[model samples]
Target: MGDGRGGGGGNRPAWLQLYDLVGKIGEGTYGLVFLARPKQRKGCIAIKKFKQSKDGDGVSPTAIREIMLLREINHENVVKLVNVHINHADMSLYLAFDYAEHDLYEIIRHHREKLNHPINQYTVKSLLWQLLNGLNYLHSNWIIHRDLKPSNILVMGDGEEHGVVKIADFGLARIYQAPLKPLFENGVVVTIWYRAPELLLGAKHYTSAVDMWAVGCIFAELLTLKPLFQGVEVKATPNPFQLDQLDKIFKVLGHPTPEKWPTLVNLPFWQTDLQHIQGHKYDNAGLHSYVHLPQKSPAYDLLSKMLEYDPRKRISAAQALEHEYFRLDPLPGRNALVTSQPGEKAVNYPARPVDTTTDFEGTASVQQPMSANAIPGGVTAQSMAGPRPGPRQISMVGMQRMPVGSMAAFNIPSQAGMNLNPGGIPMQRGPAGQAHPQQLRRKDPAMGMQNPGYPQQKRRF
Candidate 1:
């Protein structure tokens, strides 16, 4: 295990050289999860490798945050952080996880392409329930797993924990949030398709409901074997406001409005970003055409609540677990991969393709490039350089709340229309050469309120 902090690493550990290291099994926002087999151990385990932060000085802030927070989390459905190791020699930090043979993406893809086998409803129920169970625990403990997608979830192909569902990839997660920071500072989040309506509206502050939105998207994908809202993402800016992605959501879920969401109009980008499509015809009658679930069924009920446009109204993980969907005739099983009930024959999925070319010599050849589509709509989230910087409490003048004298007079002109960055809190300040969300330089005191190019009079307070 190499132990170099910024440049070179510590001496390579003998265990790393001895393990039957295999090729990559999966990739996530900040790291690569691969398979490895130790000569003395029984089965395979996952070696999640994290690259150093921006300067390549050491493990990224996101990796440290994940390693610290995940150490305290314990649940059957959650991927356990077995151990933390570092190779100072190469400045790489590795987290060991139980090797799950399959992820929901692979399972869904197998059914859609290679195997062409359909996933039974039982498997869907068990997988979703278990995933929710893990989520419920996280939310209860005040932790938000900001990234939740089909590929982020892992499942075993065999053993006592066999057929079990384990949620992975906490690189974008946050714990014990207080004096909330704007969500955009980190960079693109939740992949475009699963991103919630509020986030698209440019709500600077958000809640756990964002995760539920992703879960809803996952539920739909599991049933249909395809992304429900397959929108093409626009990467024009480092933080591009997701116009195209929002268009996709509006087409399927219908346009969000002040009538449906009272706070919808209050979002910073509501007027600046949403003014283009005010006349588009839409129906709020909902999800029936998209999901095959019966309109009145409990599954449909759960899906609808999960996809609620208003983050405040969206269903919580705990509430969703108690939904009638789980009370049906065939209750959810313990294993999502179990092909049959007890005492009956079983059908197990094929092993995932593992690259057998892991470097046992402890010398580097080439590093695998980060995959943007690792989790469908998920992006390689821009990670933070360090811990959340405390913002200086400014005077209460501009921050003061005032009643709307006239809605017509309060039009905000934004030069950066709906600019959205990846996950992570907007740090109060960033390193000298780095850029942070909260560090937006304000040249004009009026900020973006007045259009500099336009000859409009500044609002008189």
Candidate 2:
């Protein structure tokens, strides 16, 4: 395949032209995901380009966090960061993942709105097992995936990534070690609907139990093809209390008490909203209340343990993997992609949408201001103290069009006046494609110098 650039193609990296944009995979507040097909590879890769913050320069901390974790992990159940690329001109980062056809959110949406057929028991069992397997790996590593929802879990079918349900999107993943700042201090975590009760109550020091609660909600959603605890999110207020969200949970699971959850009333926000629930009684509708299933089912037990009121009592990912729900009848298949409902073939999920004519090859130019104040109790990937991981190899093309205006001190000629392409050199950058801290030229606090994956040019100014 020829480089997207019409003329002087070999002047840039050879790998740049290997990728053919299939379509856009998905878009979020964070970045845009694209399904790109490689010339050499048979299947496609999901390229997620995190949106550069309007307030700051360069990649956000979440992008760094994702690259750091995904690069270190080598698991089948987890989405692997296949490659990293940057829209050097815009300073936007792109992460290439093992492409997947469907996510649980899309799957649920398909079953509910697109198709009259519901997902089969075998498929559900397979999906749950794989989900737990991925979660167990993360929890064992002491990494809390603060955001675990249907949208974050990917499913592949009859491809290289086929029959596998990979856990993707690590925007809210945090490595928790003792003696660190309280988790909740990092602002709000997890989506409101799937959020654990403890988090809703504002627990400062929490556990991986938060993720388990979301899994339970996901489990319920899988059974019913809809969000289990669907709560209307309210806009932020000065003194915010999610009364409507809390009402959704209470109406179904009843209220927590001192006996059931000893630390129930001790949360910071709970104390502030104490008067609201002073003597109210919300009956425990149980799991069967939301989804009609047998009362004496092992699935119910697993769901109960996962949605346990007390984080202390919530089922760990490892424990959930061992539940009897998995042990019943036909065990989970190795791949949920091929797993089908009885008398039905696997449904073909559509390809992701992509936008062509995009130059995802550029570097971010940042000039930090010394007036920027240092953040306190901040747990950023760069701020964490540990043996730093090696640099991530990303495809990059720049130097031809350097942003050498007033923003940066370096001086270089424009694309027409000069030639600066590496031609065939493999692009490399610091961890998550950032520059090493030692090499960073810090003028501001937001340019997170931990991963400076930009190009080094010889200027003639």
174-220, model 2: which lDDT tens digit per residue?
76643245677667788889998877776778888899999999998
Deviation in Å, model 1, residue 190 alpha carbon: 1.3
What count of clashes does model 1 give? 24
List the lowest-lDDT window of 10 residues for candidate 1: 446-455
Candidate 1 Cα outliers beyond 4 Å, as residue runs = 1-11, 115-117, 179-182, 283-285, 340-346, 358-461
lDDT of each: 0.61, 0.61
RMSD of each: 16.6, 14.2
Model 1 alpha-carbon miss at residue 435, Å: 41
